[model samples]
Target chain A: MNTTIRILRYGDYDAMQKAGSNIPATNSSNHATSTAPEWPLWEVFVRSKQGLDHKHVGSLHAADAAMAIENARDVYTRRQEGVSIWVVESKYIHASNPDEADSFYEPASDKVYRHPTFYDLPEAIKHM
Target chain B: MSYQPTVSQLIHLADNALILGHRLSEWCGHGPALEQDIALSNIALDYVGAARNWYQLAANQINSLQDKAAFPLNAQGEATEDTLAYLRDAFDFKNFLLLELPNGDWAVTTLRLLLSASYQQLLLQQLSTNEHADVAAIAAKSLKEVTYHVRWSEDWVKRLGDGTDESHQRLQAAYHELWPYIGEFWENKLALPIDIASMQAQWLAKINQVFEASHLPQGVLPTWHQTGGTEGIHTEHLGYILAEMQFLQRAYPNAEW
Candidate 1:
């Protein structure tokens, strides 16, 4: 009777606790207290300099866009990991739904020209 | 090799690092990020270690002032915990004014850390090869750590200062608030608290280049209303700090874990 399933959108989850190994805490709610309830998870990307693509760094807590930027700089750039940063809220992100994955990504499999396999390569077009 | 450092001088020497380190540690786990928390804490630990060395040295002087014979430092007979415990108390510390202020923000801490590392690197580099083995050993180890801390601070200072409007504002504010304290580093008797006029100038020259690269304005002396920290005077914050830090050591004299 239940043949269908529900799938969550992108940025639905985050890896929050990479905290130190077994560091004792007198209060269990310290981390939770600081993190906002609707505080969107942010995906971090670090670019070492200008005109560069941002590589995924790590996640951190932030209330808004401004705080997000500041938090990213403090967390990822301490080692000068990036000259620029990109923070997209986890909730704002829209990834290909898992239920739609087959239709979304696998449709390209039938399009051979997209893979460059169908193109007839002349001897002069060596690299292509 | 050994050197002659007065008990008062040794206390101040350790005071600079201990107090600054103590202030920096307040950012622990509360830094804008986890990595920053770890990095700042590491620097704090380094200063704490350095302070312990100087305290041990200072304690030796206390031993010498006694009427007892052949007593080890921190082990003088007829000496209550009050003697050594006093040094651990914040009220007794003589750190420079530059170290006692609030940490401001990431940009400010970066600026302060950068300034500290540059001064520390140069001073410690010279000290590592000095005639005093204890000082030299501490300097040698500290120099390695300060080198990276300086690089990290310098790099971020440039990025945050030149970035978008918000970051620029954060950095500029941090700069103005912190710039006044820069002069304390160049003054001979504040930090080194000794004769080092030449070294101060040399450090300034090296530091000037990095500050320029960060696009920060040149350093200036503190405002007329604010310049007592170098000479044993302190802000009201210093006492609170002493109360917390010395609590354990004072409450239980000679207690070592």
Candidate 2:
């Protein structure tokens, strides 16, 4: 589901949009890439309620993760919202190889009996 | 000793929370920085919220069960002397020495905020984990607020305690005037008329940490202000404070905005 991603950019949006296909170079940073670098990246999470795990909420520009969580809480959870939270610097995360996605999990598709739905009995338990 | 809280026992808790909240709210418009102003006022509001919660808690715990809402005077239109007698009973509240003392200066107010928030934070944490469900819920919610309050006040206290010569002198003076009241915050439950006795030893360590970091000689521990704030007794200041706080509520019965 692709929604419109609107952002107020610093430089000439037309030049950036006309010249490139994906995100403009400046969205990644403010200054000329050759000059001083961008602000640190941060990852945000929201714990909807008690006993639930922290789900990846989103990310936005932040100088640090501590400030990021505070900003996220203000921006994301301004309403009476989640009870707990956790945040980490985006750059600190190591990614799993996307090339390995099919190789890693595709083998499990053949094991249909592994699913509990095959032998469902009680009407109360049908949803399982 | 077995737990037993008299009528005044509960009133003491309610009173302390009430007066301190009043004193803190006075700082709403006046603060060192805009950021701090926002932060302090938020803390002030939290105190008021805590005070109201404690008052209601006390009201619930009070032994009198006969027509609590039945009293028409509480809403409006009171008796001449008869109403005054009833008002006397309610106002006869006791609170901590730290809360009752004059908010002497920014230094003193900040100091009081720092120390009081620390102790309150500790107490709230203990209560949040306590066996009593009501106390625990109130404490859990209030603790987060007090933690931030303590953080905000701690920054100010440290800055003042170690800053300019004038600032240091004023800060010390604030402490000296207010130190006597510190005992009230840490007093054992004996005549405290409140159940804070469990925390005397605990709070002392936290206070000592703040003192040690401030690195100032305790010239002389101010003689404790042994009186004021218990047994329905109060300083000259409380009546004025209550008049201001309760004025709108008293005037407008059943009014909600």
Report per-candidate DockQ. 0.08, 0.03
lDDT of 2 by residue, B184-248 (tens): 55554535323465575566666666666665554332455555455445666676766776666
In model 2, the runs with Cα more than 4 Å from the true position are A1-128, B1-7, B63-91, B189-198, B218-223, B251-257
What's the C-alpha lDDT at position A90 in model 1?
79
Docking class of 2: incorrect
- Expressed as tens digits, the lDDT of each residue in A1-128 for candidate 2 is 98886675576566667888466344312221322124466677889888778888776555455545555664455465677767788888899899998988899999888887666487776324
- Indicate which candidate wins on TM-score: 1
Candidate 1, B24-129: lDDT as tens digits: 8888878655545766777787787777777776665666685534322345463322444353444456677777777876777887787777777777777788
Model 1 pairs whose backbones collide: B90-B242
After superposition, candidate 1 runs with Cα above 4 Å error: A1-128, B1-3, B66-91, B190-195, B220-226, B251-257
- The local lDDT score (0 to 100) that residue B37 gets in candidate 2 is 46
Model 2 per-residue lDDT at B170: 77
Writing each residue's lDDT as its tens digit, candidate 1 over A1-128 gives: 77754353454323123433342333423343432444667888899988778898878666666557766765677676888888988777777789988888898887776685766788887535
